[model samples]
Target: MPNLLSRGLFNLFFGSKRKAFEKLPGPTPGVLGTLGDFIGPNPWDVCARYGREYGGVTLIWMGPSPGLVLNDPAVIEEILLTRRLEFEKGNIGTQIRPTVGDTVFIANQGEDWSAKIKVEPMAQPWAAAWLAALVGPLQAAINESVDALLKEPSIDLTPTLRRLTFDGFAVAAIGEKTPDSVFEDFMLLAKGADARLQAKLPLRFVSFPEGFEAAKERFYGYFTERVRRARAALNPSAVDLMSWTLREMPTVSDAWLGHILGTLFYGGVFSTSTTLVGAFHQLQKYPAAEERLAAEAATLAGAPLTFEWLRGAPWSEAVAYEVLRILPAVRIFLRTPAADTELAGVKLPAGSTLMVSNQHLHRDPSHWKDPETFEPSRWLNGGTARDPAGSGYFFPFGRGPRECVGAPFALLFLQTALATIAARVKVHVDSTEPFEEGFFFGVVLPKGVTGRLIARPSQAASLPGSVHPSAAVKTA
Candidate 1:
């Protein structure tokens, strides 16, 4: 095997650079090297098992490259919080840059990025205020979609939910509903960019997917048109991101504004859709958990679906935590050492790749009880019993400056979605076999996740806008 010999020679010659990591315990790379770990039928499972099989720190080969996987929470905290400035988002962030632009999600640590950090604080209050304002419209949209879907025997909910989230963005940001096809096209472009990133090499070259350029052009075109429309609005309101940015930063260029909005759009839609699909899949597998969530939702009968109502639902929050913990949309967070550093007494040379698998860290037995099992109760008391982002144990939206700026918005969206769906209808997995989790270009996907939706009898008398019911009741 000339390929094997060449790799062997490469490792043999430069292996000394990895000596410190080599001393750490991990799965022995098979003949295929670490490619065997990532390119297998289920790479995430291999990563999870590695956390169980190895020590706090494990070194794995990504073909000829070496990476240190941190399963220790302290080590995770050190990188995401204390030493955040030292490490950048690395290749994955780079891969996503052209798609998301230079928003907080992909911005590196630099003076240029300092102004970007303002987005979180600025968006925090803005999101809260706008969420309250958009609650009625959002409820209408979600209820309409649910009512339409309930008539079907079985359905795939990802697209519907993605549209619901996009509508929320529309009401808050763009002031109109976006076509479902737009979201679909955006996903393709993002995945294409991810593929392009994976195919990148030092000397080799590869072409992008055939339709990527067209999709990218269309994606940017939509934003350009929307930004133009926002600028042209006679009496612009501060409710949407574009309006707010234009009002607050009058001097910023239109291109920069488009990039900011595009980043938010991708982050919001991708995280919410993938998360909802995973949450529903898990609920189908664990009926008791589903029952608990439904029971909680049923309590809100005859009451308005307010922000308070969504936040107060205990089991709803627990389920959100469990779903995000087990099936984080963004799995691997790659960072490179800003300079030569030591982690857990292991030498990490300057620019060494340091990866923290959120899946592994969240599922690490040392931090979570019976990590393999889906136990929503684990998050009951404080909602962070095992994985608290504040403690650096759990960061589904990431941590530090680069942490997801849309996290609070994401939480609000998830709570509203789970509460609304559970309150009106019950979903059951329709397939005979166990649902298989699949990784796509970036997000986690539940392949062929078909489910039956049955409206609860009590729901007929409860919420408005029910297709089965006489008319839509406006909750106030």
Candidate 2:
């Protein structure tokens, strides 16, 4: 079967008439045809090597299949914006279908995707309002998580931030806190899904990891019950993702609703956690930046952590944007030509895979000054960093019509949580080891930062509407 598959891919991508694809510059493929580079621990590093050596658009062989790494912003704009319809999430949709199902917005395409977009709660303009309404719950979640962090003199920031983001996501998504056991199951399910997406070809054909199905079932069951309970209560005044989804798609099945909720949680949590971790790590590295953030957060004393308020905190917003630019959670994005198409002056046959490296594009020397440096100030009005929204060079959340629907929520959450944390504690990284990163499935996980959370003596007390850790509700 392996030989047959290899022969099929070879014929499909390397036909005699495929002069255009054959002429594209890239490293010579190994026996595994560069598949190892993608499935290995440091695909992002390999992608950087490709961009640095091969220029903007480079061709790579994944098994016998031809995959193009789009490193140039012009080509990126062409594929992701100008000719978006020509390139869809074909291969990626197939890869994540087993985990998120085809009905979920990310995996759906064409007319179905168009229809789903309309009902997607996160895609709606009112999403900000829904998120704003949860400021109290979200702030409480952050406070509780920080309190847990303060319990120990020194600790690993990764798991702590993970719990922090998960709790915040629970409150914003489902109107309550989630149990640790459920979080464990969801992590297993997420990791398993990522494994399937990043697995080698024949293994990629395999559906789920060893215990994936069980973990998914358990995770789904918990969410299914939550969906049913939300339906039963049917609070029109409620302002969580689940509530919005229910109100928008009133007739959708409980299972379908559960999948939507699960998909958002899966997409939102880990990425936010890693971004926060990066923010803290960067802040610790640049003491002046930390001091500025602390000063800005200080002004928020006696004010609610509302969306409007968080939006006004420019430094916090800049820090979040900078961290996203420097350490994108999903390092690479996969797409495929829907039909024979030309990108960057190179013709690609239908179904050919395209890999866009966010890491490469984010750090491209041509578009950024000292691209390697972690400078949050670049995002400020007069700073050197280009606006990601306007510049094709930066797209941590992606670009075009299919850009991450959850971006607003993610940004709001990041700003609120970062400011809230800055207001409550000072993060001191005792070791440089945590700054090291590893690629997992597609998400970048930091090598757990060992840090001490020093409590700000009067910071919490100064906040007028602060929720005490003990007073924060643990249940719905």
Candidate 3:
């Protein structure tokens, strides 16, 4: 309640000050891109328009607040790096507070975030640590799903990928096998809540299960109990997050452990799944790109790709990058001004919202040579400068102090899972209608896609050493 009031007050007081923040001089558009396109097909169109009108840094209003949307790579770098400390997770953080609680999303600022930052389990951990052992389990899970795919000539690989991701990360992160029934249903509710939360819309009329909150509480209860058990059983050589966090922050309690475990599990499952589905949709939309990926797959190393091998495939990486750039899992990333601050020279009153959309950023021709063209080679070749602004401008894993912790795992999942499947079978995507794109359940997906692809064995040249026929190395 106080949060709502404070947010509303922020807009009321500083609405006019944000004039310089936007490229267009007027009110902002909705999901659609134009003045009348609020309810239009593509809301991110505004992002492109704004990028053209505004320079690198611009501001726009959405959902009753003003957010500074950045298009320039250099400014994104400054915001993500030099001046990162000045920002916070904004209303999107507030909306997700119900599920994430004091977890990092809402705690995107202050000493709490800084403290958590100290223990962030990111980057490529040592090769032999449990963190590194994760690639094996994730790959295995992807292989299993691919093998399962062979049974059906055409299956909606979206949920199939979702299930595999759930299992992959569960085994790697927490050492559990999520029951498909429970996990699938959980995916629905969790994703639904996330979409609304991400939208920063009012949830006054929403309905939920009687024990929804309690069930999550119980899950946390179980998570901490398991953490405690894992702590007690830890060997000096064991290198999982549980053991690592315990060794570092001996004062950490069950709630923190639970939050870490639960958040990782949730973030791990849906984001990867949606990305894979999105890529598949777009690849099918453009058959030539799909065939090109398959051609690269046919001659992949004779052995399946190891994490090392798969990670280096420029074409494969482009596929994943294009997927992220085009079909970003969520619509907008929002952050609050921790206090009064200046953004890219605009005087944003303290407490205003800040938003940047990948959908908008990805399509801007100013940065990308041909924003509308679906050529994976452009991304692979780096024909255009890496990015006009810098790294964070085109980021899907976000940037700086608040970037995603599960990024390595997510990429590992993508490269490994897609490689495993591509190695084993060919995707002959046939759709009844255009793959209806949306941020369905928050993670994103085709609205109603009924398509089937033929997965036939390919007897093409294989990359030696990196991947061998039937031998697999994967990620999730």
Candidate number achieving the greatest TM-score relative to the actual structure: 2
State TM-scores per candidate: 0.85, 0.86, 0.77
Q: What is the TM-score of candidate 2?
A: 0.86
Candidate 1 lDDT over 1-476, as tens digits, reads 23667556646766665565666886555344566556645655666667778856777766556668776777878888888888876766656665665566667787656767765434544556766655555666677777777766557766656676777666556566678677777777767666756563631364556787677777777776788777777245545666766776666666666756666677767678888888888887788999999999898664568877775777898898888888778776778887777776777667766767777877777667888677889887776754565455678887776677777778777878788888888766665255676655566666777765666778765545333422211210
Stretches > 4 Å off in candidate 3: 1-24, 27-42, 53-68, 123-131, 181-185, 188-192, 195-207, 232-255, 286-292, 295-305, 344-346, 379-393, 432-434, 440-442, 458-476
Q: Of the pair 2 and 3, which is ahead by lDDT?
A: 2
Better of 1 and 3 by TM-score: 1
- lDDT, candidate 2, equals 0.76
Clashes of 1: 2
Off by over 4 Å in 2: 1-23, 29-41, 204-211, 382-386, 459-476
- C-alpha local distance difference test of each model: 0.69, 0.76, 0.61
Judged by TM-score relative to the true structure, which candidate is superior, 1 or 2? 2
Q: Model 3: per-residue lDDT, tens digit, 237-268?
A: 54455665666556777677767876776666
Lowest lDDT block of 10, candidate 3: 467-476
For candidate 3, the lDDT comes to 0.61
In model 1, residue pairs whose N, Cα or C atoms come closer than 3 Å (at least 3 residues apart or on different chains), thus clashing, are: 464-473, 465-472
| Candidate order, TM-score descending | 2, 1, 3
